[model samples]
Target: MTHETRSSRRNFLAASSGLVAAAAMPPALAQTAPFLITSATDVLLPKGKAQRVVICGGGWGGLNAAKQLRQLAPQLEVVVLERNPVFFSCPMSNKWLVGQVDTNFLTFDYLKVSEKYGYRFIQTEILAVERDRKRVVTAAGSLDYDYLILSPGIRYNYEAWFGNDRRAAEATRARFPAAYVPNAEHFRLKQAIEDFKGGEIVMTLPPPPQRCPPSPYERACLLAWHLKTKKIKGHITILDHKDGIRPIGLGFRQAFEELYKDQITYVPNAQVKEVDPFNQRIKTAAGDFKFDHAILMAPHQAGDLAWKAGVIGKNAEGKPTGWSGVDPLFLNLRDDRDVYVIGDAVGIVSPQFLFYPKAGHVANRHAKIVARYIAERAAGREPAYSLPDNLCYMWVSADPQQAINVQFDYKIGDFQDKGKVILQTQIDDNERRPELIVEDFRWFGYMREDLFG
Candidate 1:
């Protein structure tokens, strides 16, 4: 705790960033200087008298965890570390892209969530997580945590599709964005879709275990809808890896055929082979396709922070899922009880059995359960196990405001063992309907109020 030790830590952190006494560091890196400040220094605000619980990433799961943790355990010092200044909701973002709603509907105050919910919000890029030291290294400095919850979200796996072709990957992302990630890609993709005058619009879908299984198809429907409604004289060609629509395949296929049959072309079993972004061309398993504009989705992995924290686990096959390795039912790391993970970054326990979908709804449910367990453990009580209920709705039509939904109910199987659990699913009226669209928006509204309040 001496000044000498603090100075050493700062010097060490700066050196780690390859910049010692970096007075001339770049503007972005200079903010935090990537310095590792000792925990003794109250850099993340005055530590106060409460035991600190640090939640990484300010997305759906992290925000929900902060909200519930503050409600259940008023004494804990909850600090949310996020890189972004404002929260942009990805759940209803598709609606915003198609002009069904405005930007205000999807944007929320990130710091306000902290202010209203009695937590400190720190805006800093997470550099590393020294689990052995029970501290998180941020660009600003480092802070120790009594309990840590990581919900850092997903990272794109461009390697699967683009491989070592970094140039092609960068070009594709720059011109034709997938908009799957909740970042600048959203805005860029929106502008691309609007600026389309006419021609073949190409879209690609990745394999299973990706975030939001039904999202690609839902977006296809919306894109087709935009073309039809606007009379843009454009056609959409969807090269899907799966056989048909996913999660709710039957219903989505019905929508595609009945609604946008002429304007949209659905190609199945079309795995990606090669991508030539400069030429607006792609070769798939099904066939070769070229387009005037495109939306591309690379496979996804857990966020970099999750990997940096070293919590990524494997599936039943013992293959890396690029997500947090944790006790399936408890949502805590296998090796450390004080650390937990939720949201899309959570590793799939068993692909054959029942795995939680990487969706915002599932993450919200995950936050509530994780909050309760943390609170119970803090109170010196053995926490009871509870499962998350996940429901996701996709809007298929902006004209009639029609949508479809899927619900998953998770429970322990009779033969369930440690680190493995079973899931039960239900689809309500499992088809596109006008009534479900209202329910979808209503659910979105209620969730926003609960989270952003």
Candidate 2:
């Protein structure tokens, strides 16, 4: 798409003041607009060479945010800090673990995205965030910014499982890889699966609020499919902490029963009490289970940068919440307005009713909102606040080419004794069509192009 086309799409939403009340808008208007504007306010422009936006983490949220910010305000300097030189997508990476697709299909060069989008990309680890000084200290150097955007993703909560023994946690991670992070873990798990001759393969699911809600189930289904197709003599066991699969419970339940009932065993509400990697045994509240091979999806928390910066901590109720508190409408830090938090790092405190899932598509949508907000503010105009929508698809089978989809819309509601934002979800699972599999590739392509191309 041309620069003009991209700007026009963003401007269309900016020009429509009535889009703020999108819940009551006409169907025609709602269908065309991508977000619902919530509020607007004028602000004085600061004196500088050009407003600078320093974005941390070059994944979906940060990349899209930098791209859109440059498109909206060509004069502004957009800098991205990412530790990884190459970008690997977590979405659809389960296919790679199951040997359905090559790793190259899910990896991209950061230099290409930087060159195409005209943004400065730095491959350096962020050491600390000096919020009061408006600068971030990195392993390379420190950089100041007028506005900071954090999409630092998440970190595994290993302490929750292994206490203060870091070595034990690392050893356990090496034994049973969690491929959810989209890196070497993918290959580790894939090799283990390929080398397995027979016996039982175990996979554990962490509590909710993880990056992708449907991912564990998707992995289980695909692994089961792999076992049956390859004629491997093995049974796959899924241990979930929740009472049952959720968000798309009905769809996954049907898949387990109708297709892989014999090859897969699902045990829900099986909370892990102890993990004995030395003996290849997992002791859970329900019972102790042994496995020939295992994959443990550890509990998740915000990246350490957020915690070190004091951006995420206990809430008013003194409960430890491992995310940064942000204004739901604009995604800016509630305590420090100049800093914005997006993607999986966004946290919700008590009595606040915002329910945005930590998914790639949701993060992509957040990038647009933050980009618009910064662009309008720099131009001495008040940008209307907006809420993002989510579109997600999960693959169930490769041979049969079947998939499931979910779409969600959010709207601001009255702040009575309820959450401030309301969610309306629509799911398509009645018929598992092969066309959805085709659309799955199309969706990934469109998203990548939208952010990087």
Candidate 3:
């Protein structure tokens, strides 16, 4: 949690619209500028006074890399550039939206992490990346990196799929907000729930490759639990874009049917096309749903930042080849060994058993391995990434006790055993063990500190 003062660096001069100096550098070549080299792994420090490692994004993946790199490679200078002063944790946000927990509990300060972790924190937007020069461009200045780790998370594909209603959807986000980030969305959704006298409430799930796959269902169930407890006479319906719940369909079904069936209605293989705010109805592939409140978990893609930066290449299909590639090296343009893509940004191969969707836990784990690998290559050593394990808990209701768990262990290269089933647990009303609730809180706390805090 140690904070470092921001250092001045030259701006990345983009030679042309698309190309840069770093991207043009050969992998074997080394820069003459200032750099640091570690003893054990030969991690290259930023050139000159300190070896610099620049990490983009301050969420789970970025923060984890910053913390770990500062600890392991103490000599290397670490800098984290984030656009926000405070980060909102989407993990425990559902509780806040339902009036069960305070919004303050879901918000965390980056100062603690910056002050203690020896990471220079800058609050700014990354304008672009000069791959050939191995530099990052921001409104403030440009940053040269011995190695770079990119983990900007996911973005809503509102423009493509949401279409002309994008603005209206964003406007309605205040009351029937997606509650995705838990700041604006949380407050708006909270207000909507408070004003509700009791009617139909719908929460829709989009297609795959979203930040949190089980979130919509978990959110729907949590809201249903809240309404039932408040004596609100309303039915909670979850309109899913996919045919089933997710990779662990059986576990999801068991949780809904056995625990929340009374208060919730599950609709799968549904696609919501539009929302008539005036009529209070949702138009979808299945049919039209009239509800008092509607929550659309819109489709997503790699953050717009990536698309804007020209980092995402398009195929013949006209779809931006962000992480949709079937290869682990998707979007990995390693010019001069300067740039490294991890987390939701990079399209890693997914095993047929369970699709590798984006999640905070997975992103955090991915960042560590990528950070270590980048650090190794900086010191003139070969880079190697480790296997990543994913763990996520879906809340069944606001009871804080009922939940479902799915765990995965993935190997880096082998697509067949990429994801090995670890465990899946369902928590029923009768099985609401107090110890598990305590465990869940403890896990979330560790996760918060490791990621956002």
C-alpha RMSD (angstroms) for model 1: 6.8
Better of 1 and 2 by lDDT: 1
lDDT of all predictions:
0.82, 0.78, 0.65
Candidate 3's displacement at residue 239, Å, is: 0.8
- RMSD of model 2, in Å? 12.1
In candidate 1, what residue range of length 10 has the lowest lDDT sum? 25-34
Range of the 10 consecutive residues with the lowest summed lDDT in candidate 2: 37-46
For candidate 3, write residues 12-36 as lDDT tens digits: 2222321343354322112322222
Question: Comparing candidate 2 with candidate 3, which one achieves the higher lDDT?
Answer: 2
* Superior by TM-score: candidate 1 or candidate 2: 1
Q: Give the runs in model 2 whose Cα sits over 4 Å from its true position.
A: 1-48, 349-354, 426-430
Ranking by TM-score: 1, 2, 3
Instruction: Please report the candidate that would top TM-score against the real structure.
Output: 1
- Worst ten-residue run, lDDT, model 3? 1-10
- Model 3, global lDDT: 0.65
| Model 1 / residue 287 / CA error / Å | 0.8
- Model 2 TM-score is 0.86
Model 1 has an lDDT value of 0.82
Give all TM-scores, in the order shown: 0.88, 0.86, 0.80
lDDT tens string, model 1, 181-209?
Answer: 77699999899888889999899887777
